[model samples]
Target: MTDDADSGADASATDGSGADADGDRLDVGFVPAEVPGAGLTGAVETSALLVEHLSRRHDLTVYVASQHAADDVDLPAEDRVEYVIHDDLPKLPHPITAKHRALREETDALESHDLVHSYSSVFVPVLADLSTPTISTLNSYVAVCPKGDMRYHGKRTCSGPGPAKCVACVGVTGARRRQGLENEARSAYSSLGKLPLVRDSMARRNGVDAYHALSPHLAEDYAALDFPAERTRVIPHFYDGGFRRDPRTTAGDPVTLLYVGGLREFKGVQVLVRGLAELRSRGVDARLRVAGAGPYGDRIKRLVGELGLADAVAWHGYVDHDDLPDLYAGADAFVYPGLIDEPFGRVLLEALAAGTPVVASDVGSTDYIVGDAGERFESGDERALADAVERLVADYEERAGAIPDQLARFEPETVLAQFDELYRDVATGRLRRESRPSSASSPTPSR
Candidate 1:
């Protein structure tokens, strides 16, 4: 892939032909918030995978924002994709203004593609003005919730954004700490999202031609927030064909539970630790392997000591991406105990791919991903989580049997074919936004 922004100027100058000399390949512009790389969030990893898969059959140009003009990133050497780094914009006094200017540059660069598929929520408002057909993947809650995690006051799932409700939520909720000017500037931008003009601008669905939701539950949540239901398609993230392991036949003497994600408050890692204690109280010998790091690490570690679980919990802080497969395979079951409605749990997919049964909270699309391969407890319920883990252990073999069928739904070919069809429909202008009758009532909270 070429990293020069000007190298493809001739190719991008013409209106997308929808089919090149190959007759099947289309010019696709992939817009991700940041350059796709390892050790980043699941969303970026998903974009990287999509780019790899799509480049096999289409002409792909990835547009992203970076601090430097070029990055020394490692992608598959064989893939035919171009990286257009929009780092030429001058920095403004305010970080928010700088970000907006960068978005404009990226959006302008994407205008010549046959179809633009965006993985960035921040690009939604800017992409709305572009005439080219566009699809924005609903990977996060930034478009709907200013706090960006869809949690009301940083504790529970928010209903939907309202001018008054959001303003109060951002003002009163100690969700983010003001540590520096950058953090304060972000807080201010989130605060601005509560205002009527900005909130409405972000919420408008007139510009995006279609929405690709990772799960059915996520599509519903965005629909309630006024995203056009007809324009939304539920396409899940495919497993990257790594982490495949034979299903375990028997549970260990002491069950090993794995949790792989950021150790943030909204992640509900505290609840997982507390649940481990509850399980021990019920005479269940289980050990937790936490394989990620975040600001919540110290607090969760302190809670572990408070609960007298110093020996049972193993902290594998920030496990490398290549090393995660072994950790997933070693565990009997993986647990995701998030407090808020997760947009989609990519970690759950990784666990299932490793032939590990999942024990996740019934928030967001956990049930959709886990299917019959695991058990789910109510979100943030430690006792219930304990119960679910115990139940999975009792019937581990039966649940393990269902892994193949559940994993088949997200096989790369199946998912890539869906995207291929969506791309054709969009590029041909067959997929157009439909008008939805506006409702005055506020949206109900999503579970």
Candidate 2:
């Protein structure tokens, strides 16, 4: 809403309200849609990493809003950060609205902060309306797409949201097919969910004084959605420190391929299984290891059995975050065949960082993230996915060697610096919404 940063004034020259005149310590509030450990969703993971990074920086006092139980997420032990849990808060269908309402109730506590940063766009209005400046990060397509996946009729990637398309894609037809009890209650629940989503969607569309896009593609998408291009900054998500593991050599034989996320249909678990079957049919020595479970877990397992992949696939449902590095390093390649427009593929970055090559679908931010470090196939193409894995199997050393350089871009400091500066800028009303990298051209993925 403010373009004061266009004057090139430094955030250091604060008015003593947020950061002190010395620009030493900054009191900030972090309001995530959901805290980590509520499931391994990307928002939760990013929040966890932010807490870890900000806590160690003594210059910042972090206040994290907890929608889940206090003990649910074992936050880092640091005096700089505190998890403010509101157990009695109503569990509204919309997380942004819920957190906003909860925080509004604690106006005194929220107002104490120098700046309030909300990862969910819907909460931006709540904070921006207050005296403190606000920064909202668009981690998903919720602000632009009603169903939030940016899928057209649940078949393929969509350009943007429209009422006619939405009627067929979301309201009536559904982006995903309902199964089991969903079949009986789909209509009723869909109606209930739509009401809150409409309200939340409207709130997200406006009042975003500052916005962070987790990927370049998402930033471009948001820009197309009428978000201020200059104010929309592209800051990719970062993993917590200690994600590095011992160097992993290529597997001698029976190469392992890993999938470490939700098992939902849009996640392309079914496509991954089909690709694995294709790999086996082609006589490639590959094993598929799936970690993390979701509502589609049973369906995925059944598909594995049906495809005669029961022996080839191991379902390690819901692996712990700490244990992920070992899995990433031990594998020869990580497979991501996501069909939906993912905002940012953190798992893909984890695979590259662990010195394991990746064979991912060329969709969403995968192109911007993996670059030439990992192999890519057309999204949802099982045959192409199978071929891509085989290519990695043949050129393992060449691809894995790029890990160090690829990993550097997302290193904590590199990514966190962008955030640190943004925090100060937003707090001091010095963030010009138009200061963004050119969107006219797509940057080539580095070698």
Candidate 3:
């Protein structure tokens, strides 16, 4: 880390203007999937954490997709984190305009900021042009997976890198998405249906100074995307309510296996349900508490009813972020049986921070999130998932073993320090990225 004097000197060199005599100004934009103050979404959690943590040290400008007062969200007009909202965005069929708007905003912000940091891959296209340093934290598979689904054709895993099978698979959907885009100029109105979603993959590869992967293994996964390994940094997810240092150990029977994340198919909601049923048949006496709502909300409800798990499980449609603590406290074990590459499992961190033991499918950052503190199963394998959950629920040592020591590593001070390192690197052009250990599962091989 640069001392106050050296950091100030670097700032002076970058800002040429005379106003900053000491060069302490570190202008940074924390670009999120949406603005921090916006309504509840995964992006909001990350944005809030960053704003609350980074603002204590740097001048942060939070750039959002759009700032409109729908009946959904409210933003404070003034706060430590500044907001720049653009109302117009491209709809799903075409995101060209949206992409351009995002890029334009980054360019303008670069005039003031020393560097730009984003929490998602979608922001790369916008910030790539700036000579200002750039960094990103991959929250999901969107960086290498175009649909962000990690699942091809909705059922199987995607192969051969992003945009390769992505284009063909999208075309097979019969939306004629590619042709309309490729031949748009031929049409009188112009058909933009075929524009490549990964248009700036090359830029992200060459332009970004650093890309933060929350897990060590995931940093390697991006190699196929052409991102150099030297530029990839591994940092663990920063969970809320850290430093309290209470060891959360499950002491009672009827162990509750909880799953909290988007209630989508790829999240392995279906697999979880089946696994829970299998566990019950084996007499584990576990109750499942499934929270969060999404596109699969209705389908999940139907599956619960059909499987007759309505009595054994409590489905809290969508819990507010504030309610997360109580949910974590109430459960004996947290479970995530995702079928896709999850990139980094934030919920697993939240669970561990709550002192709740975790059991999740092994994919993406799942194992890294739990480390030795939790259990892992083969992705999409319901029987394997059931076995893992059963072990955690039935054994005391299994539930408490890693939960104590592993939980400490996620302390706010630790994570905030990591962010501090990234910030300093941007300000001084000296990024000494830590080769972080995998925090997801056990030291044991998952699978």
Candidate 4:
């Protein structure tokens, strides 16, 4: 990390305008969905890292909604960053509208900043008309898919969101019912996607100076929904440098395969269990370590018993973040068997950083993120998953050796440099919003 003096000197050199003289340094507003800290979800963790890195070179103010705000005891002590909490925003009737109001109110104070960066999809529309240049990070499917998981009818990956299809999917599937909302309330909230105000706001293609996609596949996904392709930037989430561990010199006796994610059905823990059964059937010696807890725990445990792999599977629900590096280093390979079009698997970065080979489904950007460092199979295919794991076990050393190269692609310094350059370009009017071509064709869905 560069000291303030060095950062200011570098900024002065880049701007070539003596803008690093304290008063002229860029002022940035960072609006993340939740209060960023360690042990939170990957998106929040990414926000925390960005706060630490960006604050070194610019003045940053983090905006947080009341409901999502938390004490900053765990946050870094960055002198150049401040936190502003907006309280008592609308909640009932229309949540998206509430988000817009809250974000707009908070960002109104940041209008004088050089640029505003939002990490929440709910606030994208509100940023559209802001006089300030804005960049939003597309972290999830909330902007297009009402259910936000990007799954059609809770089965296959959604091609893209259409008003009628999204409304029907939310009403019939009632996906938010899992959140403990009643049927009527869930329908009322989700069906808002059909309204012109809501639909048009979400489908708006321009206004923000840039959009950041965590992967190239994600950029393609959003382009299908008419997001401006010229303004979309693909940048992957970087791993925590402190999480690195030495590659395992010896494999576990039974070839331990690790999975660290929620036990939800969409997470495909059942498929991993079934794959473990398939592996046993083929006399491939392996054991599985399942971490994380969710509503699907009962079903997953029952499936393990039914498959007669009770002893071969171990459950360590909700492992702490600090212990994850050691866990990854102990395993021969880490498996991500998600069934949906995951935007990006942050776990893949964790596995690669620890020098563990990844065996993930070919869903979303899993193949792209894992690259040549891991094995991938057709999503939700138990037999194929087993085959991928078998292949990794056959050549674990070679796959593990490739991890360093893949891991370097997402190093904090490398990724932060991209953001720094982009921030400068956008702030200086060097990168302006480009008109998306009318004749552009939507890319085929990867799922």
Tens digits of per-residue lDDT, candidate 1, 36-58, equal 76447788778777776677668
Task: Give me the candidate number with maximum lDDT.
Answer: 1
lDDT (CA) per prediction: 0.76, 0.68, 0.65, 0.75
Quote the positional error of residue 436 for candidate 3 in Å: 29
Candidate 4 per-residue C-alpha lDDT over 227-273 given as tens digits, one digit per residue, 9 for 90 to 100: 88888888888777656776664566798999999877789998999
Q: Of the candidates numbered 1 and 3, which has the greater TM-score value?
A: 1
TM-score of 2: 0.84
Clashes of each: 0, 5, 13, 0
All candidates in order of TM-score, best leading: 4, 1, 2, 3
Question: What is every candidate's alpha-carbon RMSD to the true fold?
Answer: 7.9, 9.3, 10.6, 6.7
Candidate 3 per-residue lDDT over residues 111-180, each given as its tens digit: 4677778877766555555556778776666555555655555556665444446655544432322224
Which residue pairs overlap in candidate 4's backbone? none
Q: Which of candidates 1 and 2 reaches a greater TM-score?
A: 1
lDDT of 4: 0.75
Report the poorest 10 consecutive residues by lDDT, candidate 3. 438-447
Instruction: Give stretches of model 2 more than 4 Å off.
Output: 1-22, 36-40, 58-67, 92-97, 159-168, 171-176, 183-206, 432-447
Which of 2 and 3 is the better model by lDDT? 2
**Candidate 4: stretches off by over 4 Å:** 1-25, 87-91, 94-96, 174-200, 434-447
Q: For candidate 2, give the lDDT.
A: 0.68
Q: What lDDT score goes with residue 204 in model 4? A: 62
